[model samples]
Target: MLLNLPCTIAPRWRRLALMTLLLSGLGTSHVHAFVLDWSQVTWNTGSPSQTFSDVQGSGIDISISTTLAGGFYNTPTQDNNQNLNLFPDWYSNNGASSYIDVTIRFTRTVTNVSFSFEDMDRGNISGSRPTRYYWEDVIERANGWNGSSLVTPTATDVGSNILIDTTSRPGDVLYRGNTNLNWSPDGSFTLNWEQPVDTVSFRYSSGSRAQSNPAAQVIGISNISFHSAVPEAGTLWLGAFLLAALALRSIPRVPELLRIRTRSVSENS
Candidate 1:
């Protein structure tokens, strides 16, 4: 008797299970929010200013500020700092004795960020590994909007400042040596946060007190990549609710089917 009852509802039960499986799957994955192509991105700059338009496909409201001594410049032929084109553009410290501060601001919040560095002045010397240099950096985050500035950063405008080593390993600096000049082969740092961020700043400086190489003062900023996370919880729940309603709609038909089965059994008897 139990076997016969299950056979009567088997098709409906299978349909309900399939629907639930698909709807619940929505809760398990993430979607990409944005990707910035530096070459295609818009740009505007003045003596102490630089703007990256439409970053992360959000209409390009991001901005960067350099010290009076630091500013933006493009390589002779290449544009779009997205990757290592033969000729690339860059933002530099412009001979600042101290670290050059580059502050980045976004009109919308960003969740994950990856910054790429290209060598504008590493000597012509080619090697199996990236040479070590004297470089240091600090990355900080903020909640609201802030203008670019060369002045000292404040806690009100910037969140906690996290210092990061320039080298891939300890006791060393200027450390990436891959020859590809492409994004992955170059030097880069990435940050992932559970919370959204509106502002990010980087302070950079490299060189020894005795050395006067122009490359030491000039750091190449090759590209910028950032993205926001998509919201999926609502979709998951909505799908589940609709699927549940569909299963309920199937329940009423079960009684009609049972009545037909019982009538046939009586007729046979």
Candidate 2:
């Protein structure tokens, strides 16, 4: 049942309508999560704070800030900044602990969100195996640790990926964090939440002792990835309608289409 229109659509508008509809459909159909590409992430060697927005073209911002210099970041070659490398960290001064927090936040709530804290181990580069004893951390819940249990997994306490404490540390209470597994080889320890989360952040301190000035420890955070919520079919259709409406609005009005006739007269006449 074709209904004839009183006025013909402009030729340019016909083409514009077709293109708008096509582009809108393509945008909605191809939405997927991309592992945040770090190739574009850039910062000075030791800038205490930085924020990289819309990473890998994803709707997320990855931020790092610290009290002391040399907080958290990749070396020229990304020595221990995520990407499965050992996560290098800041240190502890006890009263003046060098604290660093890497927070990944999405502007809108999203799902399938997950990332990891890699090489949650410690070192002095001194002993046979030294640990980040004064180190503590919390995931999403600051200062929420319950027990005070502390363990030095290695007798000499110098190694990578070793569990500092056996009990009360694994289940996520938040920490200045002395107790959590290293979770290396790409993800034995990860923050994989089944439900959606808008913000994912972890804070950690580093130092072999509390009284002395802060030193460097090692840790890593994996590439955060998540899928954007796909719009409903109804929503897509409505969007398409709006695009077509925009095209229609761009069409020339009836008065604008009118051509006024003009008569030419000679200047001498």
Candidate 3:
């Protein structure tokens, strides 16, 4: 339903009502994609540091923490959120595995968000059938390629990493790469989604031995990209209604219009 305009409004003001209805479209708020930008941020680095604060970028904020003894976060080396060091590692072998949790919060709900999981070849606890997993989402791109390392789908060590069983948990990811401590310079894949999303995360765990950890434990993430969210249907409707109402109120009633015309005619006579 819309704002009900009085039918008795003078005919001269009908155009005003029409314009008000059209102006309501402005409330839709068609916004463009917002890529996370970190060129202005200044962050520190440590392998599971004692403490690190959250960082903010264009249209987004990021928080990184750990439940175990090792984790890492670095400011991007390049602009537009490139080369961000969000990898995982462990310093102590207290019978616990390595874990890292990264949560990216958007200023508002966005659609089709995504990022990259890079340099996941091997880790400190590399061994046969090691328990390793990483969780991510919101974009579509093939694995085995990051920029410098992977070229073809059949490239060496392309499918070396085996995906573990995650049927029970859809958000879980299992990976078992080759024995090489550092397989490729940039062995990685991407997860993309096309629907509406507000917040996304990256959670990782590994049973690789803490004593022999390598560069493989350093998993970098590319900048996330997504379009802005649209307003809800109710909000759009209400805005349109109010605009129409205000416009109609300024219109003179039929009697007032008639009196003005009559006065003009008498003066001419």
The number of the candidate with the highest TM-score is 3
* Segments in model 1 whose C-alpha atoms lie over 4 Å from true places: 1-14, 26-35, 47-97, 105-112, 120-200, 206-216, 227-244, 253-269
lDDT of 2 by residue, 1-269 (tens): 01112234445676776777665765464456756644445555645456777766665665544433335544322343455332334533442235554444556555556665555543233342253343433232222111232211112222344344424446434322334444445222455443455555555554333324333445555565667655557767777777777777777666644421111122223
Instruction: Give candidate 3's error at residue 116 in angstroms.
Output: 0.3
Give one digit per residue, the lDDT tens place, for model 1 in 1-269: 44455776788878888888877777764646565555764444223565666655555466766542233334222254454222212233222343445667777666555454444223333233234322222222222232332222222111112223345334322322222232332334333333456676654443221123323223345565566555577887888788879888767476687786786677668
Q: Evaluate all candidate structures by whole-model CA lDDT and list the values in order.
A: 0.45, 0.46, 0.45
Q: Model 3, range 103-178, lDDT digits (tens) per residue?
A: 5544445556666555554442335425532221111112222223322121123333433333524544444333
Model 1 is weakest, by summed lDDT over 10 consecutive residues, at 153-162
> What are the models' TM-scores?
0.44, 0.47, 0.52
